[model samples]
Target chain A: MNTLVLTRNDLSVIVQAFGRDALMDEVLAQLRIALREYDPSRTQSLRRQGFVYEKPRLGVLEWMPVMRVSRQVVIKVVAYNPGNPDDVGLPTIVSTISVYDPATGHLVALLDGILLTALRTGAASAVATQILARPGSSIVGIIGCGAQAVTQLHALSRVMQIQEVLFFDTDPSAVASFPRRTAFLGLSMKSAPPNVVARASDVLCTATSVEVGKGPVFEDSDLKPWIHVNAVGSDLPGKIEVPLSLLKRSLVCPDFLEQALIEGESQQLDASEVGPSLSDLVKRQQDFEAYRSRPTVFDSTGYALEDMVATEIVLKHARALGLGRELAIENILADPRNPYGPLDVQASRPAQDRALP
Target chain B: MNTLVLTRNDLSVIVQAFGRDALMDEVLAQLRIALREYDPSRTQSLRRQGFVYEKPRLGVLEWMPVMRVSRQVVIKVVAYNPGNPDDVGLPTIVSTISVYDPATGHLVALLDGILLTALRTGAASAVATQILARPGSSIVGIIGCGAQAVTQLHALSRVMQIQEVLFFDTDPSAVASFPRRTAFLGLSMKSAPPNVVARASDVLCTATSVEVGKGPVFEDSDLKPWIHVNAVGSDLPGKIEVPLSLLKRSLVCPDFLEQALIEGESQQLDASEVGPSLSDLVKRQQDFEAYRSRPTVFDSTGYALEDMVATEIVLKHARALGLGRELAIENILADPRNPYGPLDVQASRPAQDRALP
Candidate 1:
């Protein structure tokens, strides 16, 4: 038995069989298990991953490595483009997810990291919303509508209740037909400025691929106190989505402190302004539901544990539903043809003195 | 239509349908295309990747970001076990593969990456050997026969003609059973010391997970004239195999010079000995085959290009047979609902702002 391969169709079937509710529950459940089991202080290193753009002269490449420890996984996403992004019709944000196995040699898996960035980014927000958002949060304000914004909506719908959603893209038109594509959700869509939805919605998500020194997307000063924000879009070596001043007023929560301190809105904050990680809040004796009392914030700089959480979710369910294919490509010589455990070695005899043919 | 998921069973079927000979031929064809199209010098730093392994008080975790630039697909593999290997009698290598369509920030597919390592490793060696090794030359010797060793042999059988096979493992049983395991190849097998096998084979493969400062496995005197050794087992930071003196004798070649210089057998060499990389030699048209005359050697550290090669191979075969699963995981809002047009992202004719119901 080996790793099961799940294609899009197989995954679709798995999702249909499990139902969206169960899949989100499992993803969150795995995230908690991974978070509780991991501690950054003990792990060895991050995973090495790559991205191949295969574009003409712009064969851009990105190699990223990450580490997951202490209730979260830390990632360093880099872009490798010899040709400027302006020259080619491509975004320069190249990245990878470095996942750590909480046990053993910590030599767990080295997966396709770029995918981790998308899933974990969305999953982390979903996890936080599960704990902090209002029980029946149906309306969401998606700020900086882009690729990550789509994942935010998908993963959020997986875990929380989304009845109506509002979107705000700089171009305004990207979200024009959001309803037609997401009609499966049966939720009506509204288009508005970031502030309009940020003020009206119970949950707010901001995912913008902004460059460093670029202007902030959402003004923290304007956010309604009860609105739970999922800050995902601004994920680069040096980029920010929500401003520092807004972060100062909110009881900040992050996936990992290290990532937030550098890449998230936390990067712009002084030491005292930074908040506790998601694990810290989740583990506390206080009611996790009380996150809105003090105007809580989730400054997510996506981490590796989210990938672990997502992978475990996929693997566990795939196994149960038989969603994936098992490969013999990594075949070990463990056949019953010979007594000595398939390699044809005699376990009963000295390992060094076997006769050759 | 999206990434087609190929389970080992699917992959096995694909391979069988194509025939082993044809699959190897396909891999060879892919290698040729990869080489012809590859210009490592042109790829940017984003394409270069590594991982972060941290230390925590409770357990160990590794952050692995495995990415490929040619594909724009990144995956993060996570394996977590506090003290798993000895406690559970398991191979402490658990992982997942996440495929993404980065342009739209979509998670195309998430596959189990454990098998990916083995398949990619074999394909990598095959790619290197196909371009570097002389065709019609065989007679092989393998060191450290373990999980990876099996695939190496299978992939190798497809490319070359092996007349005599040699095995030398510290574990005597591993050495003795070589004949039967390789019976399908109809090659000669024997159990001998490292030096003896080093002297016997034309292509010497050092795949043991040995490191520097650990005594060398073989001496320079043990090497045969003109032997092409593929040293792949040493890939991480400090892991290394092969005697530095023998490596020095050969015109060193690496799948990627930048990686091998730091992670390959060359690690044993001081800063002074590091010279031009594998591509350098290729560009110079140096005689890599003159083993006795020049002592040609390839420090076979694997590269990401090989994964791109293997992926292309799998995709080609899967399409030919219509055997893999299709996906809709990526949210590419194409003009039409199909044919992504080679990673093209045309801004949809501006979204019509419509309120969702």
Candidate 2:
């Protein structure tokens, strides 16, 4: 009943308490295991419908269900309405996660998924990099410098010996200071043009949501063999960040094939070209050596189950440190003695009187 | 910048301040306006593949995306794994809501959808009944007296004149005390058989989450030709209470057809038998009149846009009455005054250490 409400500071506390590297390292571990728990047969794709009375003539709703067996968590998130990115001055997508105790079905914790989303997305890229990238790939190119960009560097640093970072944003000045932060991480950073970063960096990460529906970011000519590409930007219908020709030529692997086909860069490519899931990689993992020889595409449109995994990790860490503010948002019936009756609210009279009578 | 965290007590303050009737009226108004803003061309299901990671061989991740309009809010709620009912003695679904300020692309509020889900769900049912139910019809028959049943009555009391309510729950004792709470609304209550209550009441509501796979509760033969059966439980796959035969016989109108088809009692019958959407009732303006002559079915499967409406209402009222608690659960950059690049925790080490360490 005492659910801890972790503040933004708590997340920062955890980041500082456990080095960011250690956090991303653990996050990837948990996510990898979470991926293992996915059983296509057991999962459910929920339905949604709403009333639409105007132009465009459609009301919408969505339901997604996921399970992380190793972590013992199941996650579902519904993003409803034709939420516009321009209207909110933020990502159109809004999310929240419910962490439950699988052993007892007890509702455990509820956390903000926006940050979790940015973290897990970056962590997923780091995960793919850990499995596919050359071990000492110290130089990295981050094509987008938005919210997920910061986390990408944070998570990647946790897994690889990230000695240098190259940053690019449409507004070059927006990310001119990337080098300053890397200095604290004991790494140097530079501002580079798209080609310079893509051509010189050992690993490439695309984290732009704006790239959706425009065109591919890189052509086959831009990518280097053995250099891994982590595409985390576009994750919706008609969204693709990497060109089909580039994807076809690369040793492609996706977080989930069904997903990549619908949202990832693979959405545009022939189904045969998109490659297998991380599960496939785990199964035929012996070919890990082959990753070094081929140009690799790590298409990561984030997974919601990762939020649950990250939530469990956050809860576990928060509980261990005894961090978080506890507040009761759900009204617990005052008269627990009357199990079948309504919750009493007489105390609310004072507020009403102060405002009205 | 200030998000008030409204606890159950706060919710009580909310109701007391606005008065239950006022709240119901406001919710209905909001629901109508919400329906007016939906646009189908703007919404394609949020890509589910990206968020779900099927367990290695067992489960999958689910996140649904539903969009409304250009100026309105679109939301995604993650209702992770539902707790096992018997083992946990709790509702299986736990969820949260996120409201986006699309103009600035900023995530404005991360809310407790668990609370809003129940509130909005009950509010939505009341809207349906207010517009669809017969005039002056008060006495009610509730098929299953679960958690939603209590809210069902509370919501109806605000919209209709009722003097009595009869409930039928598997656990007889569960409904034994059901009548007392509604006593304040000038109503008496009791436990009665489906046939008995179905015959006596002018308006009947079936609220059991249990369905046909489990077995039907009442046949079409049990319904009074004049009764309005508000089916609120058959909203998920594998959950149905009203028999398909009842659906065939009645003038059925659904909150959302696509949803009811897969989750409602309509699922038991072929898709052909399910009637038009509730909007169609609004469209043709005939459903309300036709129902007066025969048993009417308001197939109520919850919708996300309604949640958006409810959230918008609760939040508007919550802010006006100073309810909700502020949560500092979002990200905090090191330099709050002038944040740049990835957060440098080291730069803010002094501040954090001063606070804790």
Candidate 3:
């Protein structure tokens, strides 16, 4: 059978064709459907939800998350190595996406998930920023300027008009290099300390690689009223970007309650201590005015549904534009009943050349 | 940056170069390591083991099993559609394997898992047969002659000196078509009923796609004394190949107890009723002769470790032979800090055509 292989360059072309606004809108729509369809009760059961494996070694930690979205199935295999960029000059986190036909278990497409992950993650935050951030919010504060920071700014721009950005990073090189890369966005950018960014902005985002059990990125003493916080970095258990005091005091909303309870900033607090989920906000089940009245935190742990949405959109666009090439990766036998048909083709050769024949 | 795509044909060449005995030996060695490394207590944790997702729709049931083995990660996305062969003329079960580098999260290879799966599965049973099957057993009885049956014979041939084969299938077409495939094996063969095969054989293997909750394929009374049975078909929760009476009487050894409790023939009985695991047998922790004196059943449900072993071997062989084509599926930037390097290449295009400038 034919397996369509889409390169990162091919996906970039597709992204260019659709534009970021259209891509963001499509994923935003999928997020709504995903929120509605996601069953928290079925998480442990193998029948509906896919399984995840995390293999941690001395130098590397690998994560494999698999999920089935309607007729399509997706498996993402990723590795996170802290030493990659410094030692190997590779991205700290890299991944691949494989999409399959759920009916016959045939792999339909293979995609580069690194860029897709950044884009989809940015879109998820943008969705929250649209629903939770204050009206006419002009200034945005961003902590941790990495590859994700670029998309975060671009995605937020699709939903809200921002005139300036206050960004900070521990790495001075990353801090110095941000403007030349983001100068194309045409927004006035300020390099600020974490506390200054937290105090001056109407909206804040924390996306750091700070170790768990460490203090929050910014001190809670910097008072900022009605400032919406998108806690993106605190996705692993014990990794908290915002202080527990701030989280406990604010109106907290998680992307997904079950995941946030384990991986997001909300993991710092008890399940009962947190407020409604982002689904509740997206569905208009929460009191928006009341939630916005106090400081609000959107605990954004990356979700599988977002990846499913991104993969689907990418595959759809690639197919429409005839962008990907087919590889002979699946062996579809001429006779469906006989699995050994392929072996027979090679069997005509001499026995000494092959062991099977 | 490069994903080495190994086609089924390329894998076949690698398989030919390596030879089955060498391949089987390497996998058997890996199995020993797997048994030693597998910790059943960590089944639920994301650190050591991955989770599994089972999506069962009205028309299809899809399974996505992800696993991380040391520094190499693998995701097998597969679908099981009963109507595939008849409706679409595709294999009833189709799948793909994606391998990733845990250090950089870069996808290293994409492999056709259909053939690999068959080979690994056969090797698993062969391992069990070597450990549990009676000494000097010459005749092998195989039910449900399909793609797996060929591997069953081939895998067993490596470990035993087979004199004759008794095979049967409910589908007469499969029964009629077996000799052409078996002609390569050059083994004496006979067509017989399930009862006749069971009574005449020293070893038996059942690999049928029989419906769940159906009556057993053969009566408990038909089984020969000290027979070693490889129940390869009953992997689902309710699917069973051998009678419950036979299972109770036999010394049932499962590949993995937790998985076997849910998906193997042992699922028919309680957890307490099942005997030692295949790991226990592979490690020789259980009493061998005493268990072998009774009816011995290898409850083979397949495992993630077997897939890991098969994938590593395939990738190694393919690399050694230079048998795969490289695809630019991952964007590894020249400057590891700049993620927008690729977007700049296509930035000169129009705004309506694309967004990010």
- By lDDT, the best candidate is 3
Q: Could you tell me the C-alpha RMSD of candidate 2 in Å?
A: 6.4
Pick by DockQ: 1 or 2, better one: 2
How many steric clashes between backbone atoms does each model show?
86, 68, 12
DockQ values per model? 0.10, 0.23, 0.44
Candidate 1 interface RMS: 10.9
Better of 1 and 2 by lDDT: 2
lDDT of 1 by residue, A17-88 (tens): 654435555666667666655565643233323343545433323333334444334433344342322344
Writing each residue's lDDT as its tens digit, candidate 3 over B26-128 gives 7666766776666644422121132323344323333334445444556554545545665788765566777666556778788877776677778888888
Ordered by lDDT, highest first, the candidates read: 3, 2, 1
Output the lDDT of residue B325, model 2.
75
Residue A297 of model 3: what lDDT? Answer: 90
For candidate 2, lDDT tens digit of each residue in A1-357? 445677767777776787555666677788777666656555432222222323332222223345434344544342322222233333333444555443433335655555676678877887777778876788899886665676787778767777778878674534764555445455578878777878877888887655335756554565667788888776556657776766777878877667777767777777887676765665556667677556787888666556666787877898899888776544334322122225344312221222211
Each prediction's TM-score versus the true structure = 0.65, 0.80, 0.88
Error of 1 at B107 (Å): 6.9
How far residue A52's Cα lies from its native spot in candidate 3, in Å, is 11
Question: What class would a CAPRI assessor give candidate 2's docking?
Answer: acceptable
Per-residue lDDT for A128 in model 1? 79
